[model samples]
Target chain A: MDLDILINSLRNYDGITRKNFIRGATQILDETYNIGGRTALGFGDDASALDIGNDTLLLMAADGMWGRLIEGDPRWAGYCSVLVNVNDIAAMGGVPMGMTNVISVNKEDICNEIMLGIKEGVEKFGIPMVGGHIHPDTPYTALDVSITGIVGKDDVITSCGAKIGDSVIIGMDLDGRQHPKFPLNWDTTSHKTPELVQSQITVMNSIAKKHLLTAGKDISNPGILGTLGMLLEASGVGAIVELEKIPRNKKVSWDEWLKVYPGSGFVLTSKEENVKECIEMLQEVNITSQVAGIITEDKKLNLRHDNQEKVVFDFNHDIIMGIKEERS
Target chain B: MDLDILINSLRNYDGITRKNFIRGATQILDETYNIGGRTALGFGDDASALDIGNDTLLLMAADGMWGRLIEGDPRWAGYCSVLVNVNDIAAMGGVPMGMTNVISVNKEDICNEIMLGIKEGVEKFGIPMVGGHIHPDTPYTALDVSITGIVGKDDVITSCGAKIGDSVIIGMDLDGRQHPKFPLNWDTTSHKTPELVQSQITVMNSIAKKHLLTAGKDISNPGILGTLGMLLEASGVGAIVELEKIPRNKKVSWDEWLKVYPGSGFVLTSKEENVKECIEMLQEVNITSQVAGIITEDKKLNLRHDNQEKVVFDFNHDIIMGIKEERS
Candidate 1:
């Protein structure tokens, strides 16, 4: 593979570029993100954390379905909505609790399909869809879901904790197919048993309690490398990842495989001494895990393949959700 | 005032009628709303409660901005989003912990204005807006916000707890004008000191801890009588309210006052013996309070004005969010 071509494709992909808006949006609330002083982590993590007393922190996250996804298949959109939110809490090493959604659709049939999909997701994830608001007469169809989870205050994982020389681990459920309608979606959980699907979530909490990883994030719309770049940006560090060492499904080419959002996938970082146990635990849960790279103090993400290396994101110049983690 | 016309206007008011879709939407998840048995209160409440251990329940609720309101005044729409979600927690007698939002807007100027409004709201209410997702390229402008709060499990005030013969109290800040852009918005907290505005919320928690109210709910888009109808529907009970006894700002006509979404307002049900103390506590926070009605066993909400009585909602036939609170 031509390293330059692959690097450019990953850097310019819409999944990665669409994140440009977050920096500007978050900057608007920079002063108040920690206004109450209880914000344990904010703005730059899979879920925001607030110190809620009793040695626990409340984790909150929200996601809006892409309009195209909603229009093409409302059911998948609704199902994916729950999938994404659950993954967010898991990425933070928190137990999934409950979710609420705001669904704006005008057609009764479409609404039912969406709700049915949500019900399936709830059953699969073992989380409740407790309460929400519905806009019955909107001119468009949209689904926005927000979730809340709890984690031990000291055990909560954050995107900003990667240290130099730490090993970068990429874990994914490879037993999946690319969704025909939405090619970027790696369909894994739908075909798996609820027992297996739920186990994937609980495993993260166990890893957190054991202090297995220094930092972690769920692979989302930004693909694997793009998501890693975000973690690097938040941590104010970087890494050199060997392309061939990354885990992949044989059916998909490297370019496409890197971009597909797997039903259960995470990019994690841990000290070299802890990497083996972390990988072993992930494998027991059926997640294909491997140490693909090493964290670096230099703020640049470099991809290497075929004895060639190309810089995908030089944080000094390239911006992806530009806000760095602000420690108080 | 013509009681029939006022009743008809409120019955058909879009704010109340728009809620018709919740029943069908929630019914889809009827089998799974309490999937894990952690759900303490699900549908038919301002916020859903889950048993989060430590004698506490985690409260979650979400609200979406009205499309027309966002189109008319994005700033006010943003501000109201926070106000509405915060009130959802307060109605359940919980301490507002934090909030997250999903903002979908295409215009930069509009997005900034909305964020400014959110920032203002965060500062005023003293609850931090910790994290959110922004959809910067959507065709429509919509803001959906969700809040997480903590409350003692035993101290929660729910809409389903109102008992027959309980006195119904309507509490609102009557010292505000109608918003210039949205006539139905009673602008209460925008001009008040944060101390007074936040006190209104903390007072609800005090009432809950003291076990002053049998049930409570924040008066929302449905206005006074319409909100009462929802509470009555949830409790499987009805009420007889004297129109003149409801505290109101004289500037707004009875027709308009009954439909305005006040920034700080609640509909509460308490035993007759607790009515005096409840009203006194509400008054201490600048919220005008008075006992305006009595709960009844009949499944109907009746309003009396000038000695003429009219049925606003007969739950036996009329459906406003048809799902009633199912106690397990």
Candidate 2:
């Protein structure tokens, strides 16, 4: 596919469009986000960090399954609930401790399927799903999972730490196929062994501890380039990507690949000196990693392929989440 | 009301009835509740406890607002989400760190009102709502909030620690009226200063640190007697209480008071020697306190008034949550 077509498709993707809604809700929450002085990093990050003293920080994040996804397949929705929340913690380079979920369902069958899926995901991720509330008689089915993790105060990775001289790394366990029910969901962890699946997360912790990555975020529904845009927006920087260098399975088409929410994918920024080691660590865990782009002082993401270039996101005017980290 | 009548009424209360739905969901989750081994107290508790090392444990809990409450008053629903989750951590005698929420809304007005309510709650509780996900196009509106707190591993309290002969104390801030739309909601914190409302939580932390309580729980949707029944079930014990000794607002009828979800109400168990101090500390925060009962060896909760005693919950036959904490 041509650069212009791929850029336009991703720019108009529903995954990106849906994020605009966050701005309104967050605006109302803006004042109270830092009500307590212990908030180390509040909104605009994969997880909010709270200082608990003793050089330890607690990480918290929540994600809700889309109604469409839940309606299509409750089991996938349940499994994805864990995957998404776990990835949120993993992106922050924290050790995910546990998760709690709130599920609303009217049917027993659907509830059972979802719970089984969650059980599978929990086993695969190696994180306990300890406790949560169940709204048993809601008119619709929905699942929201929240995760908590811990990281050293100094070893934390955040979305707003990217710098102009950094290299943008795109990593994904590309040996997987798309989910049967949800085409956008690239299923990587399900077929893999539990030990291998968990390494995708622990590898990030090792990266964080070594101070390898300047900023990182999981490739979620917003996909690779879109997720990168969010990190850039938070960091007040931009990137110029050689589109062909982005690691992807050859089986998937370009438009679909750009929007696929992989089971294990991450977009990270690291100093040029740290790129080799960071990619090596991720590769050791079976994640295909490569330096696909370079961070730039200009606040726009420029995509290049086949001697052609196109501007996909201009942070100066575009609003992915319309948020900038409130640094504590 | 007669003892038998009240017993029957509470047994059939909707708050308690709704809990039955949790049985099916939890039964499925039981197998994996302690999958990661880090869970110190999994399931069957107000908050799940996970050992995070350094003599500190992490507490996690989630609560979803009832659809009826959301429909009745979105603002109150939003505020209650925070109140409920914070109380979960407080009930565990932990210091609440932060909360995250997932809100699903299709209407802009309802969304704004809910956010406003959440903002008010965040400010009142003095705990931040750091991060969350928003589903803007759901067919139905809902809100789920999850919280994390920290407590010394040795100092943490659990519902399953009630020992025979422990005094059962019912503590509540009776200086409140019923909510206009939700009569069972005893609205206490909204009118109070942030300091006083926060004291309601910090007092629990103090109690935990002092090791004065054997078992404790916040009075939530299941109300006073129903909540106490849960504590008894978890501890593999029972209680005999004098109904009149239960701290209650004189203005509310006995039936309503027994079923009211108090803003700051707790059913606690403490050794006889520590009961006086526990009550005094709770009372210092305007939470009216009294020793209403004694934990018993029998597996049933017996209620007494005017020499007439009747069993309220037969643990052998009744299952409030159908969960037994996997104590690690």
Best by TM-score: 1
Winning candidate number (DockQ): 1
Q: What is the C-alpha lDDT of each candidate?
A: 0.93, 0.92
What TM-score is obtained by chain A of candidate 2?
A: 0.98
What is the iRMS for every candidate structure? 0.7, 0.9
Worst 10 residues of 2 chain B by lDDT: B319-328
Q: Give per-model TM-scores.
A: 0.99, 0.99
Error of 1 at A136 (Å): 0.7
lDDT of 2 by residue, A1-328 (tens): 6777778889999899889899888889877777878999988899999999999889999999998898898888889899999999999999999999999999999999999989989988989999999988888999999999999899999999999989999998999999888888999988899999998999999999999999999999899999999999999999999988999899998899989999999999999999999999999999999999999999999999888888999988999998887569
Residue lDDT tens for model 1, A1-328: 7877888898889999989999888788888888777899888899999998889999999999999998898898889999999999999999988999999999999999899989999999999999999999889999999999999998998999999999999999999999999989999999999999999999999999999999999999999999999999999999999988899999999889989999999999999999999999999999999999999999999998888888999999999889789545
Model 2: DockQ vs. true structure:
0.87
lDDT score of residue A164 within candidate 2: 94
